[model samples]
Structures are given as structure tokens and as C-alpha cells.
Target: MASGTVLRSHAGGYLVYEPELDTVFQCAARGRLKKERVSIFTGDRVELDELDSEQNTAVITTMLERENLLSRPPLANVDQVIIVQAVHQPEWNPLLTDRYIVHFQLELSPALPVLCFNKCDLAEESELEALRSIYEPLGYFVIFVSAVTGRGIDDLARTLANKVSVFAGQSGVGKSTLLNCIEKDLQLKTGVMDHEFGVGRHTTTSSELYRLSFEHFPEIRASQTASWVGDTPGFNLLELKHPQPTEVVWQFPEILRLAQDCKFLNCLHLVENDCNVLNNIDEISLGRYNSYAAIVSDAQMEYSRRQVTSQKVEATVKKVGGRGGKEIHVPRLSTKYRAVSRRRERQGQYEEIDTDDDSIDDSLDATEDDTFQDGIVGQENLD
Candidate 1:
């Protein structure tokens, strides 16, 4: 049995590698391993038994513990999540960046989050200044690189040396191009530069590891260390599931210190009567508050919208027969309505009465009385 890490999982099976032997086996895990609910995923170290030397197939028997689990791409042992944002193209989305930063900050202990600004060739001097002011002061290492110009790739190359880093960005941010620049032979398809928006199309569809090197361009050598990078497809803008409000407030160091002065114990930093956050909201970084508002509002709106939509969906389902053409009996409107219905049912008075029947009957009687009075008045006029 050889121990190895699973690189990727495909339709047939997973790619398990025994790094010690430098042998990767393509096989599935035993039934017992799955029965015990032991999940084996990409980047998971596991013990494998080689079944056939001819086909190079093997069986994963045991899974080792992981240092960290990046849930989005399902990566198990990772060093850092390299967040790539473009200066132009889709533009710099501060809210999305904060969401990613806070997500990694809450999930990982070592705080391995690196910021990489791709397409820096188009970055303005003001953009660079803004990046330095926002990220550098927060003790984040920011690297500016352009895949086309081969600028700052050396520094980025050194950063990825002897480490496992994942490159994540929105579509058209040039993740595949960056990877291709790192490994020349990898020659991963590069998407066309969108003339309208000045962004590349999403060419890479799967998350696969590419080994970085300076063999292709010896002149670009900086450090001699084996490194790997994972390129993932882009996704829509969404808020991360942060820790509790109290914990989440402390994620931004500036906000954490300012939160001590908040009047209420559970203040969410909104315009509460004596909210310290409100008083200092403008004083501190406006970007930070903007991010907070967006996340909080997004979560609240999502929950409320889901609730209303769910009620409508349930009502529609109840009206139409559910699966198998089964009859669905909706409960009475309320406790009062249920009590009345129960009383009527006990007396065998259920005849599907119209809800407005009594009101309509009373209206008809009143109209008839008025008409008869009018008729008597007309007779007096004639006499």
C-alpha cells in the first residue's frame, strides 16, 4: 500500500498520487471507507493499494487528516487562496473582495490570503494608490501582474514557490492566461480579449493543478523550488457565510477597535440611536461601511425574499395536486378559523358555504326596504 494525495476526481475515478514514490494511481475508494462516512476529496492524502500494474489502477483505503478545507473548490490541503481581481474588465469589486477576504479569514487559522491584481498594465496610478492604502496597510501582500506583458510574474513566481496556492477570480479576469504564463508547456487555451469590456473570456472550466517552473524561460528564474497552482472557474457575486455578527465585526482590524464604543451590546452598526459606528462611519474608511452594508443587506434581502417566494410556491403546490396526483388538504387559515370549522364539522354543517354569503344576503334585504319606502313616497306624491 502506498500513501498519496488525490489531485482530481473525474467520471471514472479520482487521481491519487503517492508523492513519496512519485506514482499517481487512478482508482476509486473501497466500499468500507465510504460506509464509515470518510470523505476523500482532492488534495486529501490517502493510503492506496495498487491493483494492477498494467492499467495503473489502485484502491484508496485510508484518508489522512487535512490542515484546511476550502469549501468552494473542495480543496483539502492548501497553503493560500490567491484572490485575483482585475483593474479594468469586470472592474475592482471591493465588496466581493471583502467577502473573499473575510471568508478565508474566518475559515483558516494561518491567515493565508494573498491579493493579486491581474491586468495591472491597465492599472491607473490612482488605482495603485488606492490598493496600497486599502490592502497594504492591513498587512496583506499585494502583487501586480499582467499575463500578456510578463510583468511582476517573477515576484509572483517566487511567492508560489514550494507552496500550494489556488487562483480564484471572476470570469474574464485572465486566470488561465496567468497559469499559462507560469507553465509555458501547459499551453492552456487562452480566451479572447473582449474589446467591448477589455476582459478575457473564461477558458478554463475545471480546477486543475499546474506545476510552475522557470525551465521554459531560464532568464526569468528567481528561485529553484517546486510549486503548484490551481486555477478555478469564475462565479457570481455572493456574500460569504461569516461567523456571528460579533465575530464578523472584528474581522476588519479598524472596525474591531472602533466597536468597543458601540452603545448597544448587540448593535449591528446601523443607524441605531447612539450607534458609535454611525458617528464614526464617515470618519473611518467609507469602503468598509459600504461593504458591511452590502453584506448585511444581501443576507437580509435573500432571507426575506426566500420566505415570501416559498409561501407563494407552497400555495401553488397546495392548489395543484402534489406528485402522484395526491390530494393536498390545506389547514384552516388560523386558530379562530380552525375552531369555527371544528364546531361546524361536529354539528354536520359542512356544506362548503360561500365566505361572503351572509354579507350579500344582508345587503339585499336593506336595498329592498329602501325601495319599498321610495315606492310609498311616490304614492304620496301622486295622491
Candidate 2:
């Protein structure tokens, strides 16, 4: 068996790169892996079998455990995420940028998040300064680069050295263009912004990991370190998840710091009295605060939704023995409407009571019986 890293995944199979051999092989996964529902994603370390050197093909038999994984781009074991945005053309959106930051911060805990603004040549110096002023102080490593002018490319190259970095941002923000500029050999496709829509057309349709060598950047040539960069398809809509209402503050570093002095330990900083975050609101940027507020509101709604869903599930479903003696969740019937088993009826504990008119209890029992039958059908389908 041979060990390699998955560089890309497609409908056909995957492209696995073996570091020791310095070769890439077109590989297909083993049948057992598919049967087990083991997903093979880019950047995953996998063991290979059935190697064919002449055909440059192999079969992936095993996948090693990943250090981390990002669901949006379907990447594993990423060291850092560079959130790229354009200062012009497509335009800069602070709220959207913050959402990405918070999302990665929550998903990739302890992994660094770098902010890169592309198309600097189109933006005024003051505009650039304003961006730096907003995010630099918040401990974000910010870089202003123009792929057209080659500005800050050296700095960006140096930061990416020896790490598996992912380039993520809005489409048409010049992610592909900047990467092409960094390495002419890349030649990744670039797109133009739509004049009417004010958004860039999608150029990168999938995520692929590319090796960045020192030869690409003269400044880092002496270092002899190579980096791997995953160019992911750009997206406009980002949905933040997992963070609870109170935990939302943790994603905003500045607010989290100020929240320490709040009067209530669980204060959400909206309108709570003696809230230090609200008291010192001026210290936080209006844009950042607005993003925080929006995210917190969303988180609160999600939390309420989850609470209601869990309660509903608890009320409607119950654990019961399955065919193979395994416990499974099955639809539960209300005690009031439950049908007495034949064994219970056989005991003759109570006499059968007959009513002249149709009773509400009988109707309810019939409805519940139908519902129970439907639930059984759903469970069987799931099985």
C-alpha cells in the first residue's frame, strides 16, 4: 500500500498526489470504502492499493484521519484561510466579510484567518487605509494586493510558504487572477464583473489544491519552502452555524474582550442593563457591531428553532426495539389514544363501553392510528 494526498475530487474519481514519488495518479476508490460511505475530499491523506505505474492509476483503500475539514469548500487539513475581497469592481462588503471571518473562526478553531483585499490599484489610498484601520487592530493579518499591478504579491507569497492555505472569498474578487499573477504557470481562469449586477461571474467552479514552489516568488527563493494552496469556488451567500446565541460574541474578538466586564455573565449585549459592551459601544466599529447584532439575532432564532425541533422530536418519537434487537427511534402514540394490546384486553380488566354517537376519543384514536402507520412507513423507508 502507498500513502498519498487527495488533490482533487470529481465525478470520475480523485487525483492523488504521492509526495515521496513526486507523482500524481488518477485513482478510484475501493468498493468497500463506498459501501462504508467514506467520503474522500481534497487534502485528505489516503492509502492506495492496486497501483499501476504505466497507466498512472491506483485504487484508494483507506483514508487517514484529518486534522480539520471545511464543508463549504470540501477541504481537509487546512492551515489557514485567506478571505479575499476586492476593493472595487465587485465592491467591498464589510458585513459579508465579517460573516466569513466568524464562520471560519467558528469552524476552523485555532487556524489563522488572513484578510486580503484585491484590486488595490482601483481603490484610493484613503480607502485602503480605512480597511486597514478597521480590521488590523482586531488582530487580523490584512494585506492589500492588486493582481494587475503585482502589489503585495511578495508579502502574500511569503505568508503562504510552508502552509496549506485556502483562498476563499466572493466570486470575481480576483482570487484566480491573483493566484495566476503569483505563479504564471497556474493560468487559472479569470472573470469580469457584470456592469448591471455589480457582481463578478463565477470562473472557478471547483476546489483544487496547487503546490506553490519557491521558484514562483524570487523573494522566497532562498527559503526552499513550498506551500499548498486550495483555490475554492467563490460564493456570495454564507450561512453561519453551530455557534449559540451567547457564543456568537466569541467570534467577534473585540466584543468578547469587552464582554468580560458585563454585569450579567450571560448578557448578549443587545439591551441588557449594565452591559459593558453596550457601555463601551464606541470602542467597537459600527460596522462590526452591526454584523455582530445580525449574527446574534440569527443565532438566537436558530437556537429557538433547534429547541422547538428537539422538543417536538422528544414528544413524537420514542426509543423502541428493532428487528435485530437494536434500539431505534419510532413514532410514539399518546397514552390517551393508544390501542390496548390483545393481551391486555384478554385480562378483562374493564367492560367494553359503547356510545350511541361517534365519540371524540374514537376519532382521535383513528387519526393517531393513521399517523402511526405513516410514521412506520417513513421509518421503513429510512431503513
Candidate 3:
């Protein structure tokens, strides 16, 4: 059996790359692999049998242990995340950038995120430095590159060596363009596999790993380190899962530090009296602070929204009948929403309906009293 790493997972099979033979082959997992409830992801190492070196194909018999897993695309054994963001055009969004960071932490990714600013040629150097100042202090690797002019391309390329890095950030931030610039060979292969090989474009939506070679681009990386990159489509706008209300600040290293001086241990830093974050707001970048506030609010709000949805979705089915037939009874779930569920909670409709009913009853009572109160009877004339 030959051992290989899965470079792409789709089409009910995989493109496994065996370094021993220095070749990539199309392989499918054993039928029992699915029965065992094992999921195969890109970047997974597996044991292959029934190898056909001539056709460059094989069957994956077993999957090896993984070092880690990435969120969103959910690739395994990720070494780093290249957080690419544009310097202009769309403008640098600090909130979205920070949100990605929090997403990484929430996923418990062991890899460090590399902050890369693309389109440096369009924006000013001061703009680039401003971003660096915030994250550099937190021990993040920051880079500025222009896909047009190839600025900082070689530097960014060198750092990717020996690491299974994934490019993640907002769309239209020049991720594809930048990658194309760094790896010229990508142009030769735009779409997925061809029909003859039964390896057409990956039918699955899972992320696919592309192997990087020093031989292809000698100017960038000299050594082959099993380096691969996964272009995580739709992962650009990473939606964070619900986090605890108090756990939001802990995600921000800068804010969490000053939060120690807050009057309350659980201070959320949003308009709280004597709040250290608000009191010393000038000490931090106002933009970042605003971003932080919005992130926390969004996380909390998202959490609340999910909770309401879950509560409403929980349903109990009841079957009632004798021996003839059975009736499936599904009870309605409570739709009561929390005060925080909405921006402003309004009064219930029951109270308004009751008030209107009471008013109508009072009018009827007066009408009845007046109709009977007339002592002079005109009913005899009518008869």
C-alpha cells in the first residue's frame, strides 16, 4: 500500500499526492470508509491500495490521523491562515477583519493568522502602517503586497514555505488575483479535472488543496516542503457562531487587557458606569474600539437570534388513536421572544384586544339602560 495526502476531496473520490513517488493520483475511498462514519477532507493523509502507476490512480484504503482542522471550509492539518484584505476600493474594514480573527479563535485553530494587506499600490503607506500598529503588537505577521506591481510578492511567497496555509478574507480583496500573480502555473489549470480522468471540477463544495512547487516558481520558494494552499470559497464572509456574552471581550487581546481596570468583573464595556474601556477610550484606536463594540453586539445578537430559532424549532409529536388509525398531533411551540430579541419590545396583542372589548361592552350596557329607561311606552301605538 502507498501512503499519500489528499489534495482535493470531491467527485465521490480524491486526488491523493504521494510524495514518495512525487506524484498526484485520483483515488476513491473504500465503501466501508463511509459505513464507519468517517469523513474525508482535503489535506488528509491516507493509505492507498490497488495502485496503478501507469494511469496514476489508486483507491484509499485507510485515513491517517490529522493534526488540526480549519473552520468554514473545514480542511484538516492547517498550519496558517493568510488573512488577505484590500487597502482601498472596498476600504479596509477593521470590523470584518477582526471578525475573521475571532472566527479563527472560536474554531480553536492552532495555526497563527498572517495579516496581509493587498493593493498597497493603491493606498498610502501610512494606511498600511496604521493596520500594522494594531495587530503587530499582538504578535501577528503583517505583510503589504500589490498584486499589480508584485510588491512584497516574493516575501509573502517565502513565508508560505513548509506550511499548509489557507487564504481567507473578504471577497474582491484580490485573493484570486494575488494567488495567480504568485503562482503563474494556476493559469494553465483554471477549472478542475478533465472528463477522461473522471476528475472533473470537484462536485463537492468542500475546499480543495493546490500543491505549490518550487520548481514551478524558483524565484519565490526554493525548497519543496509539502506546501499547499486551499482557496476557501464563500469563507470570505465568515459568520461567527454564537459565543457567550461575557466571552466576547476575551477574544480581543487589547480590550481584554484594559478590561481588568473595569469596576465590575463582568463589565461589557458598552456604556457601563466607570467602564475602563470607555474611560480610557483615547488610549486605543477609535476605529478598532468601534469595531470591537459592533463585533460584541453582533455576536450577542446572533446568539440570541439562534436561541429563539432553536426554541421555536423544537417540536414534540404525539400519536393518538385506538387500533383503527393513528392521529399525529404536533403541538405549537411557544413563540414568546426575549426582550433582547428585538430592538424594542411592544405590548402584547391580547391586552389591546381586551381593552377594546371592555369599551364595546360599556357602550352596549348604556344603550340597554336607555332603551328600557323610557317610561312612556310607544309600543302600543306601533302595535
Candidate 4:
């Protein structure tokens, strides 16, 4: 038996790296894991059997307990996220940046996100300084680097050391370029951002873990710096599992701290007369405030939609239970069919009524005739 962490999941198999021997084993997971619907993902520590040291291969038999897991790309035990942003190419969309923050906040526990501004050489000094001023005060480490000039690559690499780090950012933000610059041996393929659209093509199609080398830095030991970094494919925007509307405040640390002073416990800060967020500061940055508002509204809309959908799902058409649980889909009702049902009920009632009006009239006429005959017979006897 051997132990290894899955470095990457490939076609029907995984690339497992064993730290004990600094070796990699290409292995397939046990069949039972699939039957149980347990997913095998990258960064999972697994127990391997059928080991062949000579061939560096094995079969994974057990998946160990995970520290955490991010279901979006299914990476486990991620220590931190490096959110890359190009300074100028995509025009530094602050709303997009805010959205990315909200993304990891919901997905990653303890939510460690370091905002990295890449391609700084292409942007103005004022632009970079603004981000540093805002985010640094908010307890976020903001790294300004120029992949083209190899600036701040060392600092970025050192930060990722002794931690499992993953890069996330918008397309064309130079995510791959930054990694390529950090480790020359990686030589990751980087795509050029489109001049017309200002968006970068997807250069890295999949997420894969790459080992970081500190051999270049004599002060840093390669053995100590031995760590893993995963570069995922860039996206225009990540689909998010929205937080509750009231929960959106917690996503913004600066605002959340001030929100405690609000008069209302559930202050969204938009229409609150006594919002501490507004009282504490004249106003949050327009960009930040707008993003906050947008997020809250989006969340509220999603919550409403979910409630409606849940109501529909709960309104069962028919339940076949206690006899081999079968269900029939309830069909939706419309006015036309409802009217037809009512009409059929009325027609049935009409048919059930007795038609006795003609009999009653004939009985009345017969009684009158009998009275007349009796009167004539009595008169004859008197005479």
C-alpha cells in the first residue's frame, strides 16, 4: 500500500503525487466510489494499492477525509485564491472584481482571496495605486506585477509556498502569463487579449496542478518551497450560488464591520435611514456601493425565483406511495379546462331533476271535474 494526493484528474484516471518518494502514480479509483456517488477530485489525499514502484503506477482504493472542497471546479483543500486582473486590457472592471470576491466567499470557507493586479506596466500608476489603497486597508494583499517585465513574481511565488493556491480571474487577465513568469520551467501557453473586444481567449482549457521550483532563489530551499499551484481556465464570469439578500453585507468586510452600528438588524444599507455604513463613512466608493446594491438585488431576485420554483415542485400532481412509489406529474391548470369541468357538473345535475310539472296540472283539472259531478248529483236528489 502507498499514499498520495491526487495532482490532477485525467481521462478515467488520476495523477497522484507521493510526497514520501517525490513520485507520481497514474491510478484509477475503486469501482465502489462510483456506485456510492462519491466523486474523486484533484487535491484529494487517497490510499493506493497495487503499487509498482518501477512503473510509478497504482490503483486508488480509498479517498481520505478532505480539509475542504470547492465544487465549482471540484478542487479540494485550497488554501488561498489568487485573483488576477489586468490593469488595462479588460479595463479593470471593479464590478467584475467585486463579483469574483463574492464568488470565493460563497464557495471557499474562511475565504482567503488575494487580489493580484497583473500587467501593471500597461496601466497608469494612479490606477494601480487606487486598488492598493482600497484593498490593502481592507486587509487584502494586493500584488502588482508585470508578467512582461517579471516584476513581483518572486513575492507572488513566495506567498503560494507551503499552501495550496489556485489562480482565478477574468479571461485575458494574464493568469497563465503570471504563472509562466513565476516558474520558467512551466512555460504555460498564454493567449493574447483581443484588441477589438479587449478580452483574452481561453489559453488554458483545464485546471492542472504544477509544482513550484525555488531553485532560482538560493536563499529559499527547493525542499521547503516544494508546493503545488493550480492554474484554471479563465472565464468571463463565474456562475455563483447566490447568498441570501440580508447575507450580502457579510461579503464586504469593510461594510460588514460598519453595519454592526446600523439601527436595523437587517439593514441592506440601500434605503436605511440609520445605516452605519453610510454614517461611518461619507460613502463607500461608488464602484463598491453599486456592486453591493447589484449583488443584493440579484440575490433577492434569485431567492424569489427559488421560492416560486420550490412551491411548484411541492405542489405534487400525484403521489404513488406505499406500493412501489410511483408518481404522476401534476398537469398545470388553465381557465378553459376549468370552465369545461364546471359545465359538465351542471349538465349532470339538470338530468337528475324530475319532470313532474305536466302531472301536477292534470291532477288539478281532475279534482275540479269530480267536484262539479258531485254538486249536480246532490241537486237531483234534493228535487
Candidate 5:
């Protein structure tokens, strides 16, 4: 079997690139893999069997272990996730941006998160400085680039060198356009901004990894390191998984650091006394704090919902043996519908005997009295 990396997955099959031969093959997964329900995503290292050299086709037999996998765009073994946001047109939204940062932090903890703000040409110098001031201190690598003017493209390209990166952001933020500027050969489809709705139209519908070439950029050409990038479909709404309210602080590094100095070990930084985070709130940006508050609120609600659901499950469901002796949870039967045990039925029968004996005795006494009265009446009639 030959080893290769999956570059794309489509309805037809996968496109696997064999680095040893520097050859690309159109391949389908083995039937056994399909039956096992193993999913193949872009950036997955796989083993190919049943090669047809003439047809340039093969069958993917095995998927190697991944370093990390992201479920949102469904990419594997990512080194960094570069969140591409716009500086103007769609308008830079801090809340949405923070959500993206927190999402990557939770989904792919090992991978680094970089912020790349596109359309810098349209933004003022103050705007660019303001962005850097907000994110740079947070240990995030920030890049201001304009695909139209090609400003700061080199810096962006350097960051991508020798890494498997993913470009993700809201629709119509120029993710595709920026990539095309870096590598003109791609010519990825670019969408126009919807002036009516003030959003960018969705152009990328799926995720696909592309090998980057720096032949035009003389500085990076000497390094000769291979760089792969995946362009994923853009999205606007991001729903975070339910985490504990206290755990939400971990996503915000600034708050987490201050929380360590709080009087309470599990300080939420809200209205708690001696809360270091709240005491030093001025150090944290207002926008970041607002985002943190919103996320914590959502997490609290989700946690409550889960708690109620668990209680209901415990109350109404019971474990029972199934056909093959496997245990399963079934709904508990109501009291009126439950079967009575044989021992209990016998006990009830014994309890009713005393009441039956008393009724028989009373009937016998009444019969004796009636007989005496009848005899007296007959004797009087004869006289």
C-alpha cells in the first residue's frame, strides 16, 4: 500500500496526493472502511491500495491516526486556524470575533489561533492600531492585509509557511479573495457583498486543502517548505457547547489569569466579593468582557437544562435486561399498573378471613330470633 494525504473529498471520491511519487490519484474508500463508518477528511494521512497506474486510480484502505480533528469545517491535523475577518464592509464585530476565538480554543486546543483582518486598505490607520492593541496582548498573531492592494500579504504568507492552516470566518469576508492574491493559480471564486443585507454572500460551500506555492515570493522560495491551507465554508452563527460557568473563564486568558488571584478558588468574577477579575476589570477590554458575559450566560442555561434532563431520566427510567441479556433503560411502570407479587396476594387473602367469620355469626343470630316469633303466633291462633 502507498501512503498519501487526502486533499479533498467529494461525491465522486477522494483526491489523494502521494508525496513520495509527487503524484495525485483519484481514489475511493475500501468497502470495509465504508462499512466501519470511518470518515475521511481533508488533511488526513491515508494508505492507498489497489493502484491502477494507467488510470491513476486507487482505493483508500486505511486512515492513519490524526494529531487533531476539527468538527466545524471537518479538517484534520491542523497546525493553525487563521480567523479571517473584514475591517469594514461587513464591519468588524468584536462579539462574533471573540466567539470564533473561543470556538477554536475549545475545538482544537493544540492548534494556534491567528487573527487576519482583511480589507485594510479601506480601514484607517487608527482602526488597524486599535485591532492590534486589542488582540496582540492576548498572545494572538494579528495580520492586517488587503487582498485588493496586496498589502501585508507577505506577512500573511510567512505565517502560513510549513504549516497546515485553515481560513475561516463569516461569509463574504474575502477569505477566497485573499487566498487568490497569495496564490493566483487558485483563482478561487469570490463573492460580492450584499449591499441590501450588509453581509458577504457565501461562495465556498465545502472545505478543501490546497498546496501553496511561493514561486512569486522570492523570500519564501528559498525555504522550500511545503505549506497546505484549507479554505472552509463561511458561517455567521456559532453555538458553543455547554461548559460549566466557571470553566468559561479558561477560554478568556485575561480573565483566567486574574481569577487565579481571587479570594475564592471558583470565582466567576461577576458580583463576588474579593474577585480579582472584577477588581481589575479596567485591564480587560469592555468588548471582551461583554462577550465573556454572554457566553457564560449561555453556558449557565445549558448546564441547567442538562441537569433537569438528567434528573428526569433518573426518575422515570429504569435498567432492565434485554433479549440478549444486555441491560437497557426502559420507562418505569406506574404504581396502578405494576404487577402484585404472589406472596403479597396470599397475605391479603389471610387478612380477609376474620371479617368473613363475623358476618356468618351475625346471620345465624337473626335466624334464631325469627323462628321464636313464628312459634308464638301459631299457638295463639289455635286457642
Candidate 6:
């Protein structure tokens, strides 16, 4: 079989598409991909060989290089990310937008992010105008489209032509409605607008790409053809681990502009002395700054936790001297592992101690219940 992108993944396996033939193949891996800890996500281009047409099976032999990837939904080779937000329903969550923007900027090619304000007709004039004014000036193209009335639907349709776009936003933001409007033929299931909450119930349960067709173009008046659009299920809030401050700042155009004047080269941007970020912080969106601050704080806490954890790992590795032949050095923490030894003294069920510098930290402070310290090792990679 030829190379194709993985559109959907399931317990059975993946559905890969060959654009050349416009055919979909059901493929599975010979070995457990997750066992190796490399999650083969959707939007990944892979090489496949047909196992048996009768069995509807194929083997995924190779995965193609990806332009960008994300851990949460685990997708790859995405062309652009559509950030769907509403003018009124569920109100505006700039913090959520920050989360999306932060994740997108970390991508390899600075993937294009388009903000679509759905339910435009429902929005008050001031609300609609305010959103356009804020995001449009910041380099992001803001489109005001009403999925119900078809207001600006032509422009929205033009934007989505011949592209792979992911519709992402909080629950009830009209992602499905917008898709239904764009590809009217699909008549994709959509929930009614909630009068009480002013939001729609999430009708989509899983992420799936749909082929959109237009019979007659309003401008060209030519024959209709099919275009691809991917719709993702709505999420309440994005769960993001602490990311690097440099990466976080880079995501926000406004913050990055202000960060240039920061006092220190490595300013954390939180209560730093003579910090330009802090001084003009109010000028920027409060929600955006808070999101950045939260991630930075998480990173700082994770760092502190790692220091404590490394000390323990170093001591354990020294005691075991395992055959891994790895040198255990716990920086940011004292070489002495006495603190961990003392802490574990009361626990009788402690198994073999791990002292590898890169070993994951298991230590957690009871005083700070939700606080997690960042260490050299990640949540999954730790031995």
C-alpha cells in the first residue's frame, strides 16, 4: 500500500487513508506501539502493507516525519489549528485561548491558528466588535460567522477550502454547528443552543474528519467538489503540564512583545524586580498573563520537586549499583541522599531504591497536596 495519514485510532487499530487512491485502510502494528511508549496518534502519515482484503487488515510498517504534534489529543501532521470561541455563549475564556495558543506555538512550524467567533448573530454589537479588535490587531485572523444565519459563511467556507483544520474549543462553542454550516450537505448532528446556559450540548463524542462538498460555488459557479475538515469533541478545560517560560512567552504575541523589555535575560515574569512584564502587565489581557503565570509557577514547583527527588534517586542508585551502568548525579539537590533515606525510614514496603539521576521522583510533600516538583525525569520516562 502507499503512504497515508492516520485519521482515526481505536482499540482495534488505525484507519489510514491513501490520498492517491482516496481509499481507507484498516491497519494494526505487529508489536505494541504503546509498549515502546511511542503513541502513534492521528494525523500521522504512515506506510502500510495490506495484510488481507477479506480480513480488512493492513500492517503499519513505517511512520512519516511530522511537522508538529501534541500530547493531549495525540495528533500529528496538522496543517492549521482552528481556535473556536464564541462571542457570548459560555462567554469568552481568554485563559482557554491562552492554553491553546501556548500549545500551538510549541509546535514545529508555528502552525497557523485561526480564531473563529461562532454564534455571531447572538452576540451583542459591542461583544462582537471587541473580539475582532483584540485578536485581529494581534496578527490572528478573526472571523465573525454565524453558523445559524450563514452570516460570513462564504468567507468561512473559503478559509477552510482545500485544508486540514482541527476545530478546537471549550464545550458548546458551536464547533459542530460551524462544521454543519460549512458543509451543509453533511448535515452533521448538532445540538440546540441552550437558552439557560447560552451554550450547546456537546454532540460530538470523538474526533473525526468529514469530507465537505459544495455543489455550486457562489463566485465560480463551477461543479462541487469535496474538501476535508476535522471536528474534535469539546473539552471543559485543557490540562497542560508546566512548560518552559521561554516557550510560554513566545506563544502570546502581546506578551512576547512586552517581554523584550524585561530586566533580566531570563526573567520569570512573576514579581521580578524592575520587570517590564510586571509593570505593563495590566496593559495586556489579565487572563493571558494569569495563564502564563500559572504555567511558570507549575514549572517552578516541578523544578523544586525534582531537586528533592534527584537526591533520593542518587542514594538509591549508589546502594543498588544496578547493571544499567548509568551514572547517577542529582543536580539542584545535595549529593547526599539522607533526606530521602530518612523519609523512607518509616515506610516498610519500600522496594528496591532507585538512585539514577534521571529516575522519576516519587516524593510528594503532604503540606502542599497539589504541588508537584519538576525533576530531570518526566512522569512517564522515570525508571
Taking the tens digit of each residue's C-alpha lDDT, what string does model 5 give over 140-185?
9999999989899999999988999999888878899988888889
What's model 2's lDDT at 99?
A: 81
Candidate 3 colliding pairs: none
Give candidate 1 regions above 4 Å deviation: 51-53, 110-112, 193-201, 214-226, 301-383
TM-score of every model versus the real structure: 0.72, 0.78, 0.72, 0.77, 0.78, 0.68
Clashing pairs in 5: none
Q: In candidate 6, what are the lDDT values of residues 9-32, reduced to their tens digit?
A: 644567777767667777775443
lDDT of 3 at 47: 94
**RMSD, model 1, all Cα superposed?**
23.4
The TM-score ranking, best first, is 2, 5, 4, 3, 1, 6
Cα lDDT for residue 51, candidate 3:
86
lDDT of 1 by residue, 1-383 (tens): 67876777654456776666666677676655544445655677787775566787877766776676766555667788888887877677787778777666654544648998888888887887788688887778999899878988878877777788888776677888887787878887767766775544655555666556667656545555556778766543442444434445656767756766787876777668868878777666778777876666655665566678873211101134678887543221212112346675754333323121221111112221132233332221111
Model 6 has an lDDT value of: 0.61
Give the Å shift of residue 83 in candidate 2. Answer: 0.4
Query: lDDT: which is higher, 5 or 6?
Result: 5
Tell how far residue 125 is off in model 3, in angstroms. 1.8
Residues 1-383, candidate 3: write the lDDT tens digits: 68988877544467899988998887766755554435667778899887889999888777887676654656777888888887875467787788777676555433457899988999887888888898898778999999878898888888788878888765456666677776777742233324353221322223567777755468655566568887654342424443456666766668877886788866789888878888888887776788778877876776677688874212212235647776533222112211224323233333333342211111112211122223212222111
In model 6, what are the clashing residue pairs, if there are any? 302-373, 302-374, 303-374, 305-373, 306-375, 313-355, 317-355
Each prediction's whole-model lDDT (CA): 0.64, 0.75, 0.65, 0.70, 0.76, 0.61
Model 2 Cα lDDT, one tens digit per residue, 63-112: 89777777666688888999999898788988778888877776576555
Which residue pairs clash within candidate 4?
317-330
Q: List clash counts for every candidate, in order.
A: 0, 0, 0, 1, 0, 7
Please give the ranking of all candidate structures by lDDT, highest first, separated by commas. Answer: 5, 2, 4, 3, 1, 6
